[model samples]
Target chain A: MLYNAFLQAIREIKRNMMRSALTAIGIVIGIASVIAMVNIGKGASASITQSVSKLGSNNLLILPGQTRGGPGGASSFAKPFKPNDLNVLKSSINTLEAVSPVENTSMTVVYKDQNYRTNIKGVNNDYFTVQSLEVDLGRKFEKSELRTGQSACIVGKTVVKKLFAPDENVLGQKIRLKNFSCVIVGTLVEKGANTFGGDQDDLILVPTKMFQRRISGNNNIHMITVSVKKNIPLEEAKLQIDQVLRESRHIKANDEADFTILSFTTLLDTISQITAILTVMLGAVAAISLIVGGVGIMNIMLVSVTERTREIGIRMAVGAMAADILIQFLIESVVLSALGGIVGVLLGLAITYGVAIGLDIQLILDPSITVLSLLFSMLIGVIFGISPARKAANMNPIDALRYE
Target chain B: MIKLAGITKTYGSGEVATQVLKGIDLQIEKGEFVAIMGPSGSGKSTLLNILGALDVPTEGDYSFMDTNIRGLSKDQLALFRRNILGFVFQGFNLLKKTSALANVEMPLIYQGVSAKERHKRALEVLSSVGLQERVDYDPGQLSGGEQQRVAIARAIVTRPKVLIADEPTGNLDTKRSHEIMQLITGFNREGITVVMVTHEEEMAEYASRIIRLRDGMIEKDGHHAV
Candidate 1:
C-alpha cells in the first residue's frame, strides 16, 4: 500500500513540477548555505592550525611586559628584558634548548637602485637555532663577527628577491640600511605567509650588538624566544620558565607577574576555539533558512490538500483508508524535501570548492556534516508534513465528495 | 440485503441546525434493481450516501447481510466498501489523467489484488462494457457516455454484490441514458443488487422497483410493470 502511495506521490510531483520546484526553493537555499559556511569554516581552521604549527609548535615566547588589549603595548611600570635576562634563562632553565633575545624595527633596505621597506630583526646566533631557521645559501654569521659586531647580515628569501637580480649571488652582496652598509653572509630558506597575514620572509637579520649600536641605539630587548627540549611537556617547561623569570625579576609572591609566557600550543588552542564558535554561529544562521523552507512545505501541502478535496473524496470512496491518503501526501512532501536537500548539497560543495580555491586553503569536506545536513533536511520535511497529512486524512468523505 | 430503521442525519448546531435526513425506514433485498427518485432539495442523494456507508446516520440501526453496519469502525467500513460494494457517480468520478483500464483497476488495488490479476480482471470488465478498444484512453479523451461506461466498468470490476449509483444518467442524453439503464438492468439480471438515484422518470422506469422521496421521507414505493 505504501509503495503504491509512493508511486502516486511521484506522479503528483511530476504533474506539478513548477509548483514543486517553487516549494523546494526554501530548503535548497537553507541547506546550501549551511554546507558552504561549515565547509569554508573548517578549511580556515585547518589553515590556522597548519600555520601555527609551522612556526614551531613547541616554542614559547616571553614578552617584556604583560600583554594588553593590543600587541607590543607595555604598561608604564613594566620593564624591558636586558641581555643579562637571556643569559639567566639559558643557564638556569634545564628544559630550555635555546634562548634568543629579539628586537625589531622597520627600515628601508637599498641594494643598487632598488629599495624596499622591510622589518630588520636583531638577534644572536641562538635565534636561528631557536626558530628552526636554516641558511639556504652561504653560511651563518662567524663567531668573530658576532663578538666584534661587524657589518655582516643574513637576508630572508623575500629580501633577497627584492634586493638583487634573479641570478645575482645574494651572498657577499652589499645592502645599505639608513646610511650603514652590510654584506649579506647568508640567505634564509623560505617560510610562507603567517596566519596574521604578514610575510614571514620579508625581513633581514643582524647581530644584536650591531642593531643596538648602529640602528636603534638601545640595549633593551623587546622579547625572548625559548625552545623547549624534546620530550619535555610544554606545561613543565612553562612552569620552570615562569618560576625562573619571577625570581630573577624579583617579583613578589602576592604581585601578578609583569611578563606573559605564550606557547604555540596555547595560541593554536585560542585560534581553534574562535573558529569553532564562528563556524557554529554561521551554521545556525543557515539552519534558519532550512526551517523556513520546512514552513514553506507545510504551507504548500495545506493548499494542495484543499485543492484536491474532490480527488481525496474519490479515493476514499474507492476504499482508500485515511492512512493511505495521509501516507501519499506525506510521501510527496518528504520526496520534495529530500530532493531539495540533494541539490543544496551539490550547490554547497561547489561554493565551498570555489571559496577554498579563492582563499588558497585546503578543501576539507567533513563527511559527517554532509550526511547530517541531508538527514536534517529530510527531518524538516517530516516534522512539517504531519499536520497537513493529518488534515487530509481526517477529511469527511461525504463533504469532500460534494465539494466543488 | 440491507435494512435501515429510524435513520436521522442532522447538520450544524444551535440556531443554524438543519436536518438533512429525517427519521426514515427502508429495506432492500439482494438481486433487486431499485431506483430512488426525488426532486431537487429532496434527500435522495443523502440517503444514497448513507446507504453507501460514506456517512453515518445520527440515529439509526443499519444492518447489511446480518452484520450491524452502524457499529463498524472506519477501517471496517472501508473494507466493506472494498469487498462488497461498488459506486458510480453522476460526474463519472473516474480519476482524471488516468487511463480507463487503470481506473477500472482502482477498486482491486484497494482489495490488495496482485498486479497481474488486477490487470486481467480489469481488462475483462472493460471488454464487458464494450470499451476494450478504449481501455488506455483517459476520461478527458472520451465522450460523456463513454466516460460513464468506464465508470460502470470500474464499479463492477471487483464483482461486488451491491452497486450504488448516484444519478447514473443525469449527465447523459436520451440515447445514452437508455443505454446506461440497459447496462444497469443487465447487471441486475446477472444477480448483482443495484440501488440507483435518478430524477428522470424514463430512467426510473427501467428498475424493478421504484421509491420516490420528498422532504427526507418516502412518499411512494411500488413495483414497475414491465
Candidate 2:
C-alpha cells in the first residue's frame, strides 16, 4: 500500500514539475550555503594548524615586560635583557637545549641601486638552530665572525629577491645597510607565510654582536628565543626557566616577575580555539537559511493540500484510508527535501573544492557533517510536512467530492 | 440485500439546521436494478451517499448482508466500501493525467491486489467496456462517452456485490446516455445489484424498479414493465 502511495506521489511531483522545482529552490540554497561554509572553515582551520606547527611547536619566547595589567604596573618600567641574562639562563636551566638573544630594527638594504625596506634581525647561529631554519645556499657564520662581530650576514628569500636580480649570485654580493656594508654568506630557505599573515621569509639575519655594536650602539636585547631539550616536557621547562629568571633578576617570591615567557603550545592552543569559534559561528549563520527553507516547504505543501481537495476526495471515495493519503503526501515532501539535500551537498563540495584551490589550501571534507546535513534536511521535511498531510487525511470524502 | 430504517440526515445544527433526508425507509434485494428519481434538493443524492457508505445517517439502523454499517469504525467503513461496494459519480470522476487502465485499477489497488493481477484485470474490464484500444489514453484525450465507459469499467472492476452510481450519465448526450444505460443494465443482468440516482425519467426507464423521492420522503415505489 505504501509502495503504491510512493509511486503516486512521484507521479504527482513529475506532473507539476515547474512548481516542484520552484518549491525546492529554498532547500537547495539553504543546504548549499551550509555545506560551503563548513567545508571552507574546516580547510582554513587546517591551514592555520599546519602553519602554527611549522613555526616550531616546542620553542619558547621571552619578552622584556609583563604583557598584562595597567601601564603604571611594576614591570612596565623594567629594563630589557642583556647578553649576561642569556648566559645565566643557559647555565642555570638543565632542560634548556639552546638559547639566543635576538634584537631587530627596520632598515633599508641596498645592492647596487635597488633598495627595499625590511626587518633586520641580529642573532647567533643558535637562533637558526632553535628556529629550525636551514641555509639553502652557502654556509653559516664562522666562530670568528661572531666573536669579532664581523660585518657578515645571511639574507632571507624575500631579501634576496628584492636586493639582487634573478641571475645575480647572492652569496658573494655586498649589501649596504645604514653606513656599513656586509658580505652575504648565505640565504635561508623559504618558509611561507605565518598564521599572523606575516611573511616568514622576509628578513635579514646578522650576528648579534655586529648588530648591537654597529647598528643600535646598545647592549640591550629585545627578545630571547629558547628551545627545550627533546625529552623534557614543555611545562617543566617553562617552570624551570621562570624560576631561574626570577632568582637571577633578584625578584623576591612576593614580587611579580619582570619578564613574560610564552610557549609555542600556548600560542597554538589560543589560535586553534579562535578558529574553532569562527567556524562554528559561520556554520550557525548558514543554518538559518536551512530553517527558512523548511518554512518554504511547509508553505508550498499547505497550498498543495488546498488545491487537491477534490483529488483527495476521489482517492478517499475509492477506498483509500486516511493513513494512505497522509503517507502519500508525506512521502512527496520527504522525497523533495531529500533530493534538495543531495544536490546541495554536491554543490557545496564543488564550491569548497574551488575555494581550496583558489586559496592554495588543503581540501577538508568532514564526513560526519555531510551525513548530518542530509539527515537534518529530511527531518525538516517531516517536521514541516505533518500539518499539511494531516489536513489532507482528515478531509471528509462527501464534502471533498462535492467541492467544485 | 440491504435494509434502511428511519434514516435521517441533517446539515449544520441549531437554528441553521436543514434536514436533507428525513425518516426514509427503503429495502433493496440482490441483483435488483433500481433507479432513484427526484427533483432538485429532493435528497436523492443524499440517499445514494448513505447507501454507498460515503456518509453516515444522522439517525438510522442500516444493514447489508447481516453486517450493521452504523456500528463500524471509519477504517472499517472504508474497508467495506473497498470490498463490497463500488461508486460511479456524475462527473465521471476519473483521475486526471491518468491512463484509462490505471483509473480502472484504483479500487483493486486498495483491495491489495498484486500488480500483475491488477494489470490483467484492468485490461479485461476496459475491453469489456469497449475501451481496449484506449487503455493507455488519459481521460483528457478520450471523448466524453469513452470517459463514461472508463468510469463504468472502474465501477465494476472489483466485482462488488453492489454498485452505487449517482447520475452516472447525467453529463452525456442522449446517444451516450442510452449507451451507458445499456452497459449498466447489462451488468445488472449478470447478478450485480445496482442502485442509481438520476432526474431523467427516460434514464429511469432502463431500471426494473423506480423509486421517486420528494421533500426528503419517498412518494412512489413500483416495478416497471419490460
Candidate 1 C-alpha lDDT tens digits along A1-404: 77777777888888889999999999999999999999999999999899889888889988877875434455536698777777789888888888888888899999999999999988878888888888899888888887777899899999888888899877888899998999999989998777778888998999888888898787877788888989999999988888888888889877888888888887788789999999999999999999999999999999999989988888888888888888888988988898999999999999999999998887999888889999998898889998999998999988888888
Q: Interface RMSD for each candidate model?
A: 1.0, 0.9
Give candidate 2's chain B TM-score.
Answer: 0.99
Quick one: RMSD of model 1? 2.3
User: Candidates' lDDT values, in order?
Assistant: 0.88, 0.88
TM-score top scorer? 1
TM-score of 2: 0.94
Task: Please provide, for model 2 over A1-404, each residue's C-alpha lDDT reduced to its tens digit, 9 standing for 90 to 100.
Answer: 88887788789889888988888877888888888888898888788778877777788888878875322232535688877788889888878888988888999889899999999999999898798899999988889998888999998999988878888898877899999999999999998877677998999999999999899898888789998888888889888888888877778988978888887676667777887898788788778888888888898889989888988888888888888889988988888887788888898889999999998777999888889889988998898888899999999989988888
Pick out the ten consecutive residues of candidate 2 chain B with the lowest summed lDDT: B73-82
Q: Runs in model 1 with CA error above 4 Å? A: A68-77, A166-170, A192-197, B14-16
Q: If you assessed candidate 2 against the hidden native complex, which CAPRI class would it receive? A: medium
Candidate 2 lDDT, B52-87, residue by residue in tens: 989999998899988999999888888888888888
